[model samples]
Target: MSNRSRPDSAGSPRGSDEAAQGPGVSAGTAPVGTVLVVLHQARSTPGRIGARLQRRGYGLDVRRPALGEDLPQTLDGHCGVVVFGGPMSANDPHPFLREETVLLERALARSVPTLGVCLGAQLMARALGARVDGHREGVCEIGYYPLEATPAGAALLPWPDHVYHWHSEGFDLPEGAELLATGRTFPHQAFRYGMNGYGLQFHPEVTREMMAAWTERGAHRLTHPGAQPAEAHFSGFDRHDGAVCRWLDAFLDAWLAAAPLK
Candidate 1:
């Protein structure tokens, strides 16, 4: 099922190679490719990341299998795929999620650049043969937190001191995946599973509006054991928003540059 929303018009048409040199597009700096954005729910759409990518001259093909749209069988025409977070567990017995996992596996096998956020990251972990489930340890992570980057993470992208997070479950680092960032509650905060695939446990794509919607909708879950209050997540967003946005811009630029052209 597809959402009524469409890709930003500022971006060139999806998957057009000539878009790289199109008028108003930055010569040589912009990445020319269409990103296949997989949405699990209405609230967990790409948000800020989609806006940033449009400004960077990349088109987005948004799809929602939960709404009846078919998940692409191959990463044949797109340059990359990004799976956004949602409330559902990666292990949920949902047909759409099963299909999403398979699509992620195919994306990696084809060397297409792929990124996963929160539950999306968990899905990637499962696709790569790693374990993902609710936080077994009595602790759940919610709100803003700090991340200590590994040497590999620092070399790959600009690692901010802190990032906005709103997740209760985490995943074990997939086999052969490079550990990029770590947090106190969940050691596996970020990872790179393949040459072009990344998984982030936090919501780097979140904007203030997105956070508001989530906190309002999931207010009941915020009271879960060890879960931080909504205010805790909102109050600190201002302090970290600038740095996180900067890091996201740089990260997306690098990620898109690495995507193999189809």
Candidate 2:
């Protein structure tokens, strides 16, 4: 990552002026804009999603409020915001978690391009006045699982043959939100709130490295009650890699083009 690309939270609440330039200043040159990537843990880097955005000329300021860094008060200079998953639940009493939800509220209300992955999706749901809690009893999906897109989902998004899942908690559909996809174990797999805000319950941003790190650390959770082994999550990566990457690229390109950060 370039020094200007990955801004940390140590110095200031807001990033440097250079890091605040919004996206698409040039067609094929270096990325001129910045995207705020809210990371919950060190291991959960933006991975392939971040890489794609960078290739499209978007710099990333990856922040971790969990480490006592303050989140920016506004999205004035960011083209988009993406919150990655974590082991922590959105319902936790931690102040940082609450702040994350508040940030999501601001992002959605302002119509900034917003994406939430897994636990981040739960936070987005909470921000939108939805219930976020544990999955139904006897259902804990932890590996690659099938996602059935709704009619609306089929129309709006590409259908990945299967998406990777690791969450034990699921979200309820927020008021006025459209359910884009569903799973057998967890009904709410993906949703869209308003024009620019999206919440995905699966890890579309996962790369081989991120998956290895997660499985290595979360090995216990894989075989715990109602879960599959770690290998199940990765074995089909070879088969699913092409479709998944294409889907993410197309989805993100369309998403950014629809309503870029103002």
**Tens digit of per-residue lDDT, candidate 1, span 186-259:** 88999997678999998777667666666676676667666678888877787888888889888877776676
For model 2, the local distance difference test gives 0.74
Pick out the ten consecutive residues of candidate 2 with the lowest summed lDDT: 1-10
Q: State the lDDT at 121 in candidate 2.
A: 88
Instruction: Show the lowest summed lDDT stretch of 10 residues, model 1.
Output: 1-10
Q: For candidate 2, lDDT tens digit of each residue in 1-262? A: 1111111221211222112222333655655578899976544467667767776777788899987878998888787999977767788888998999999999999888899988788899999999987755745777688888899988986788688777778899999999999998889988988888899988777666556656666676666556767677678666786788888888887788778643
Residue 103 in candidate 1, Cα distance off native in Å: 0.4
Best by TM-score: 2
Flag regions of model 2 displaced more than 4 Å.
Answer: 1-30
Residue 196's lDDT within candidate 1 is 83
